[model samples]
Target: MIRLATVIDTFEADFLAQYRDQLTPDHYRALAAMKHCRTQASPMMQVKCTACEHQKLVPHSCGHRHCPHCQHHESQQWLERQLKKQVPAEYFLLTFTLPAEFRTLAWAHQNVVYDLLMSCSWETVRTFSQNDKPLQGTPGATAVLHTNTRRLDYHPHVHLVMPAAVVDGKQKQWRTKPRGKAKGGYLFNHKALAKVFRAKILAAIETAGLTLPARYPQEWVVDCKSVGSGESALIYLGRYLYRGVIQENDIVACANGQVSFRYRNAKTTRRERRTVSGAQFLWLVLQHVLPKGFRRARNFGFLHPNCKHVIALLHVLLKCVPGQTLAWVKQRAPILCTCCGAVMAIVRTRIPSPFTGQLPISIAAEGNP
Candidate 1:
């Protein structure tokens, strides 16, 4: 189970020792947390089996959103929740990308820029959905902020999971039918999407006192592709919610103060490996660590948590059983005994002594000593 954390745990102290002055508190904190994550530095709990009387110690995860190791459970929970909100209609994956001129500043002003990106994307979807020519109903969308390009470059963009169908504003009834009997199921005008999206993004930039080059293209990149059935796509996109720009599985090698990892070539559609210094690799991952308490995924229109009643009404409109959604998201307990087939219960729990970085000798001596 060698992972990115293994490299981090081994090399991060040296990286920090050399580059501490150049890093931020968040970067230092993230690296420290990841280094100690699920290791001796973290707290542990003692769970005992009722039948076999066997005891086990489980370490606590740092549970930081950017920690790739800890966020798998969060991703699953999000996927199931989004699936339950699915309607019997078409779905669209809309990506609103910043212009080339904006990437550098967008990284520097991440919170402001990303918030504006999400807002503009939501507004674009809302406005287009409300156009009388299309339908007067509002569509629900969830926006995911992505800060890395395929090459792991610092390119900030937003990925939106939006439905092709819109619902009546007041009635909350479906305003769209199955897109087409065949393959031509177009949702919105891509040209117009590009136009509106660019306009909103530029306006937001100016409003926030941010500047873009005057010679920049009038149209920013807006990708709108209809995912055949959104259930799988929505679930697939859920991976980005809690993960870093890349995953542990993507790492190919880590040695000699360098790290190599694979990425799918966006243009050639082929796999490629990239190698960089350990410090640079740490920088690549840390830059995407969001501001504390900043949300990476957001629900807009009816999918919002504030409008749960609206979601309930929509569920009724779509004929979804209340009980079924729970079945879709049943969380499994973690403490299972292996020696005898029985459930384990937490007999005692406490943080290990910070000074010694170890649990009490009485408990530590029992299991693996």
Candidate 2:
């Protein structure tokens, strides 16, 4: 089977061959890291119930959240973590996107564009939540940056998870609010927020001395929707981050000196086959190389400042209040061992580095005969 890592490897080389001399030191390192290694691994089991036997092995997965090959375990773990932080009230997933006309500019000014997206979105959400009459205080939120569409194009966007209830600093109360179809729940005003988001981004870019298409200064695209609940929100946004850019079904062929993949037009369902010369393919792969210490996921607002402890404190405080319940509990699902039908105990858990022959070491629970 043709692996996504191989394709990415080819692309990394192509990138260096073409732009090695042009990239800065940091960019060079990022490109090299992307080109060489980016896979993570977890233990998996194949169980044969009838035979009362099981096979345990360390499965290597493309650790790239953007790669489809490694999403299941990664996303599941992330969801489990999010579930523990769930509040009793409604949750909303808000997405902020940039216009396609800026794709080339984004590619050219990755650092500038990416920084603006994060800052602008964060400020926009924070300001809007506080200004909304229903949510009079700063509505706590967590936002993440997403730069690629389903087809791996340069579709930069931001995803935010916001609470329906905002803490009322003045009265020390929890103020609940909703907008549009999400009445009585955590909702965002898309049209209004979009307008403000556009304004904020343009202003920020201009203040930073960056120029945009002259005719499109007033036109920036932003999309917002209220995806409900923390679980649903995780599942929805997780899909975009994990298994996002590359698809297993989209693999056309891998042979000779080239590997081909398919992508669909964002505006149309029609499929298109795009083949990169082996060198060119490697260059594309290098584009995804993230700088070391660059976190793909982060928690902000109420969830920030060491999320678990902060949320635990909030949960306790909420229980003491009039409307909140103390029965809220966080539960984790059990992982069963396929081998011998025994409950598998995790002896160790490791996230492997992308370099080859690297594996995560974990031991299973065993019972005495």
Candidate 3:
């Protein structure tokens, strides 16, 4: 499988050499980070095998949020934290997608449009959950912003993980539909949900001083389905929410100035191959760096940070012991060798020469636990 670093190393120079003046600083920074990730440009550490006494230098990860190499470890860490927040409750997955028209707006004003998509989509769900027949109470939800589709196109959408049963406002208890009522545990009407979400988001766009063509499509897309278990959905969504647009497994080949990848087409329900020049591939991947400090995944209702009291009450509702707990655990680095499958120790860190124009890094000898 072809890694993103390989593609970036192959074509980042040409892409930057040709379009540096046209690209923004953030784009340049993300591309440069990807190109230099886990390379000699980054810091290196010397590791010695505990069993074989083999010593080798390995480059450290750049740890950019958009880097595919760095995000798997981060995503796994996040999944653990998110899993601890889960309650023993049935959950639903709801997706609110932007139409093709809004993708242009999102590209131009990502912060504003993306925030609006998240807020407006949540509001649409919250409002309907309060007023709809099947759902009469508010449901705790965590909305994750996804900027790319299966085809890796600039498709901005929000996926919400919400409780299948709503939490009562007055009673502070979880409630579900009567046993004979909604058969599928659905929250609201799909077409109706789409209409409301579109109207609200369009109004938000107008408020942002952008006007749309009057001839745009009347129907929008809003999907709602029961995920049965909330933890599984959270794990799946966490991976996509924290990672790069395309995975290394999707990459088929990189040679002769072209990169080829595969994507499962939604309409055709079959795998399809797409090949593009290395420069074009790098540019396409860089398009999803996102604005600096934009919080893509956010919790709402009882899960938010400011809702400590509400969270305690929720724990009571779930029969969990009530106490403020640290959920985000520190992630530990691996000691095992990637190549030889042997235990290893960090014997020292390699410091680049000052004359070479690289920043100084610490050198330390540490044994693996």
Candidate 4:
């Protein structure tokens, strides 16, 4: 498998030369973190074995959210938290996509546009739920912003994984969408959803003081499809939530100034390979680096962190077991002693990197043998 760090190290100079003027601080930061992740240039941790007292210094992960080399623990924790709030109802995955004509505008003002996209999508859904005859109440949703397509193109979209349920705060009631006889079980009219979503987002952009493109698509795209139980949908979204856009294992080869990676084509449902100049590939990946401190995933309505009691009550009333539906997240494997085979525990962390011109203080000097 080709590592992202290897690709970054090889193509960084060319990438910088080609796009230096276009690079943002977030892009530079992501490049640096992914390049040194788990390498000798990164910080180190000292661990000692329980049985044999064998001590070792391990390189620490950079822990950047965009670094594909790390954050497995964080990703799993997020999935677990979402799973804990799962309710026994049919769920739907709703996707709202920005028109191609708006790409340049979104790229120039990402934080504003992205936030508006998410907020507008949620607001559209909330509006629809309140107006629906059966569910005249606010609905809960978990929205995640994705900035790349399967081929790593700069396509910004927001996906909302929402249960078919709504909570009436005033009436103190919970109601689920009546399952329709349609083929996949209906949630809402996709066409109507697209219409409302388009208006809301366009108005939102103008309200935010951004110039609207003179020629934009009259019809935007919004897809709503049923995903049973919602656990699988949450897991799918969680996979790329912390890890970078492209997985390292998907990168098949890098040779002859070109990098090749594979992605499953969404429409064709088949695996396909795309090869591009190393510099171009780097640009494709780095262009997706979100603004510093911007949240890519969020919970709204009842799935929010502040609604634990509400979720807990629903779980009891509906007889839903949160973690029981999905397989338990396995604990991280413990470091083992080569001498005695016992587990090793971290004794110290944040040791200076060798590249920093400071020697890591010996663990033995800290009074441990």
Among these predicted structures, which one has the highest lDDT? Answer: 4
lDDT tens digits, residues 1-369, model 4? Answer: 999989988888888788878987677777877888888888899999988888999999989898888888898888888888888789999999999999999999999999999999999999999999889998999999999999999999999999989999999999998899887789889999999999998899999999999899788789999999888789889999999898999999999999999999999999999999999999998899999999999999998899999999998888877878658565567888888899999999999876842211222233321
Clashing pairs in 4: none
What is the C-alpha lDDT profile of model 3 across 91-200, one tens digit per residue?
A: 78899998886677678788899999999988888888788666578767889999877767778999999875577778756666543356556666789989999999
Ten residues in sequence with the least summed lDDT for candidate 4: 357-366
Cα TM-score per model: 0.87, 0.67, 0.83, 0.95
Among residues 3 or more apart in sequence or in different chains, the pairs in candidate 1 whose N, CA or C atoms overlap within 3 Å are none
lDDT of each: 0.76, 0.60, 0.75, 0.89
Q: Candidate 1 on 1-369: residue-level lDDT in tens?
A: 357678886567666666656565566567766766777678787889988899988877777788877877788788777876776667889988888888777767878999999999999989988884656778888888888886777788888887777768677467764576557477777789889888988888898998776668876678887886576567657776786778888888888989898888978999999998887787788877888778888998878777788777877767865345444454645678989879999877765835334332222334421
Name the lDDT of candidate 2: 0.60
lDDT of 2 by residue, 1-369 (tens): 566556655454555566655554444433322333333323232323344344343443335454556556666666555655666567777788888777677767777778788778878888887887887776666667777665555577888887777766578676666445534443665778889999898888888888886556455555665555565666666554555456556777766767787877857878888876666654454455444455556666556645566567667876623122212222334445555556544443343434344211110112110
Model 4, position 177: C-alpha lDDT score: 88
Highest TM-score model number:
4
* Local lDDT at 177 for model 1: 46
217, model 4: CA deviation in Å? 1.1
The alpha-carbon lDDT assigned to residue 69 of candidate 3 equals 75
Model 4 lDDT vs. the true structure? Answer: 0.89
TM-score: model 1 vs. ground truth: 0.87
Question: Which is the winner by TM-score between candidate 1 and candidate 2?
Answer: 1
Better of 1 and 2 by lDDT: 1
